[model samples]
Target: MSELLNNSHRRKEVLMKLLMRLHEGESPDTLRTELAETLKGIPYAEVLQVEQEMISLGMPAEEVTQLCDAHSSVLSGLVDVGDAKAAPAGHPVDVFQQENKAILMTISQVRQELNTAIQSSGEDFKKSVIALRTHFNHLSDVDKHYKRKEFLVFPVLERQGLTAPPEVMWGKHDLIREQIKGIHEILLNPELTAEELQPVVDLVIEPALYALAEMVTKEEEILFPMCMDSFSENDWAQVHEHTLEYGFCIVDPVGNWKPTHTAETTAAKVESEVQSGHFQLPSGRLSAAEVQAIFNSVPFDMTFVDNEDKVKYFTQGTERIFSRNRAILGRNVLHCHPPASSNIVERILEDFRSGREERAAFWINMRGKMIHIEYFALRDEEQNYLGCLEVSQNVTRYRELEGEQRILSYGEKKSD
Candidate 1:
């Protein structure tokens, strides 16, 4: 029994079995007590790996999401909070830390407004209600922040074989999302009296507000540190680049950050001369160098996925709407989106596969730019299904065009 408990392989087997039971609807309290004794002295990172491995082995995401609340309950007091370190300005971690400050401040203001409005009536209460309403609305922007982590950051972490932690956090993200939506829905009923608003403050708004604030603590202490320790410099650079598409929560990033490689490493990989090559395409043929230059020079960004549902390629643009890095190659496209939108993605893939749909289009107003996104299903000459191509473009400048001009004016021409 001593040797069995001491064995790392045995420990993982036990952990998986416990989690499987938990998924099978075993009592969380019972498992928490039973497993706590067995799991003592196990590194938190190892525990996270256990869960990630379970998910990858075919456990349902929904089931894992449900099990986490209970699973976390067991680890709550026993496990130590993760390391917390200061992130430098302009780094991806720095951006998240900054946003947490803004989010916490908003929650504080909402609390004050709720306190003042609960006892007051008439215009005073109405004014306070309006303030609370706006606070929660602004709080809704947190979804964009969560989406960045869920879509861009998590996939990279999973690629490195750290899957469980991201899955658990993604679950919490879903819970918080539902809470925010509930609070938003409660406020949509404008006819409610001051008395009506009080319950919302107590039941809906406060719980959600507190949850949001606590997640900041979780991100600072648990998520960010683990990511910092595990991810490489280039990995962070990839995350920073992708954040542009999702936009920030309420915080604005000050500038670009370029992670520097070590001098020794750079020296090791340096070559004497550049190797050149050519490529052929249906439209025309271009040298290998020209292919990349053309893709970057174009006003749009693009990503392609093969029929196996794997990400094959993405173009780098002067201003990327979303971040793309070589690390994402061969990753399952399903894992590339937030849980909220993954359903839509699956439906799109299913439709294309079934020959019910050939192409789909969507557009959104992001930070004053009209960003257009389109997906086309690829098929061969014999009509054999191949893959899906995603094309995204910022049409803000194009939308402002008026009148035809035969003359070519290139450099920022202005009409007065």
Candidate 2:
């Protein structure tokens, strides 16, 4: 009886070690294959013990991330020789991977053109540089994409004692952001002669492209696989809920994820219980009256027009960069503008309705302030015209912004 008990304990311990390797993504091959069928029912505590032992043995987190992938592949293979489950279409991981792939592809395209422009010097060179800047600015949206992942995805991983991947990914993100800024500076200076372009390419653009490619690989192989392992259906369900708030890089999410029965019930209860009168900020609760007062205190004027091209609402922000009043509400949007521009506004509205144009933008000097204005068409389900939104902000300071201002200061918090 003593011998049997000792042997049973030994197998259990061995089985747990194998499970941890699988979770870390390492493959012990035959050991994993043998235990795969038997490991399903093991409690999470036993699984965690194996991971703890690995850390105690001094294996790094990165090595663990790599090994965990291998382990997952092996066990996944045992389930079916060639039929491992693919990520479902539009799974957050799948969609995020697709976006990352596109970003790398765009970076590659831009780099090639930048290189070609460097080899030639003439009138065409300035055109090429301008084109390069346009393409590079598109990458700004990628920052938004990465930030969404940091806020929405990293928190869940942290709950599982995973911090290494987020730290590494964020570090890479900062590097890419810096490279992009360096490229902007190089483009702005007239010193970028053909001879100077090579250094810019090597120092700024090449590193940026390589970083972009490395990030793609890291996401596909390491970061995403770990997310798949560490997240539950419910966790992903939460990520799907919040991803749209930040938007995407190149792709619009195909369909919005709706809450299931339990989630919907919980959401309904919370919404019902919470008062809508105030927004609770980190500083304090802002009442609805206070919210209006805050908006009315901004430097820029604000307006909203529904799909029908009818003026619906406008903020009474102080220091009105463009004058707006309560009288504009419920007015035909075209009539709100000067008659000389009414036809142009009508054409813009028509194009918006037909989905031919997403935005109508213009900028001009007004009262010594550079006012940048844009109109965006809004559409709802079934792609019906919902209305247009017009936002006009004084961009005198915006156009003059040179280097980054990362830390928020007094004026930085304002967004119109």
Candidate 3:
């Protein structure tokens, strides 16, 4: 038995047979016991190879995806990782793992809230539900994590001829995303009763949470280890460089990772060229540095969402009412706000796109200051909708002003 397990070809053959049995509707519990008795520990790489082989040998990728969670459950705690390479503190894999840690922490809190909601009644139950909503909102940040993998890591894996796993994993990502959206819809009801919440907890909430946690397991046990083995240092460095474009999930990366062999990345080179050139417009031209300075020098915060609803740009002012980071670049604007308010954002975008609304404005008291926020529909000379611009400012002083001040009073103190 030891010799058979040690032989790579025989080991994979055994794994393939067992997985086929699993595909044929054998109980995971039964198969798990049999696998333990036969092959004490299957290498993670062999499992992946068997999956790839199955796909190459005529099993549809969709079937593999359907069985993904089932097989992962069976192989849970049974895959060997003693020989997996360790990631350095600031490496992209390390950052991904850290984000998983943060995600797991949030999941733990969500479970605690779930338990509390199950055990409580009335306002206490409502409070627990609200807490769950907040945690899930944080969980929604995992979209950024998944996006980084999809946009950065998956392409490299495909180039390496390892395509099936990424496809299967991306399918799983879409499933989790839809589940999270459903969970948000359920949690959005402010007056949900404990009795009403129990069914949701069992049917929708628990399943979603399980899917989330299981994906983390798949990532750490199989995906990250395989990527660590397959990707070159330069590949990792490139991934680390663009990670911020989609943003981090729940937590930021701890340290910066740069390849010792390469001095400049493609993004940096492009940025350098832009900085050295002028940005030409119909009526005027400004250097890149000057344009950036002018934007930052403005008093209010400005964010531009492109026609595709992706966040294209944001200005960094000295006193920004809301925070902005490079991580939000190219992200769907809908995902930027809390789920409860997403409908409002969607309505505004729809109205702007349809030309039914040119502008929308609102004001609120936040943190002892009056904040004014407005959204404007940007259009071309031909009246074609281009995008949407969001402007926000603290208008407390403006609201309190009794008389207009001239330029001569710019540096003068107002009378008490």
Top TM-score prediction, candidate number: 3
Among residues 3 or more apart in sequence or in different chains, the pairs in candidate 1 whose N, CA or C atoms overlap within 3 Å are 52-164, 242-323
Instruction: For candidate 1, give the lDDT of residue 229.
Output: 76
Per-residue error at 105 for model 2, in Å?
Answer: 2.2
Q: Per-model C-alpha lDDT, please? A: 0.74, 0.65, 0.86
CA RMSD of each candidate after superposition: 10.9, 17.4, 3.5
What lDDT would candidate 1 get against the real structure? 0.74
TM-score versus the correct structure, for each prediction: 0.53, 0.49, 0.85
Model 3's number of clashes is 0
lDDT of 1 at 251: 53
Rank all candidate structures by their lDDT, best first, as comma-separated numbers. 3, 1, 2
Kindly list the per-residue Cα lDDT of model 3 for residues 257-361, writing each as its tens digit. 556555346656756897999988998999999999999999899999999888888998898999876556666787678655777999999999999999999
CA error at residue 112 for candidate 1, angstroms: 2.9
Model 2, range 1-416, lDDT digits (tens) per residue?
A: 99966755665587656656556545467666667665443322233334445655666655554344343434343322122234567777776866787687788779778878977888777767766766665564467568767898989867887555565466557767787777766776755677777887887788677666666655554456656766777787778766655556655444334455766566556555543567878889887777777777876666878876656677876566666543344446654555346569989999999999999899998878888889888887788888888878888877877766665665666443
Per-residue lDDT of model 1, residues 36-151, tens digit only = 78866444455677777887898877777665556655545444444445567778888888779889999999888888888888888767766776676567668777988998
C-alpha displacement of 327 in model 2, angstroms? 33
Evaluated at residue 328, the lDDT of candidate 3 is 62
Clash tally, candidates in order: 2, 13, 0
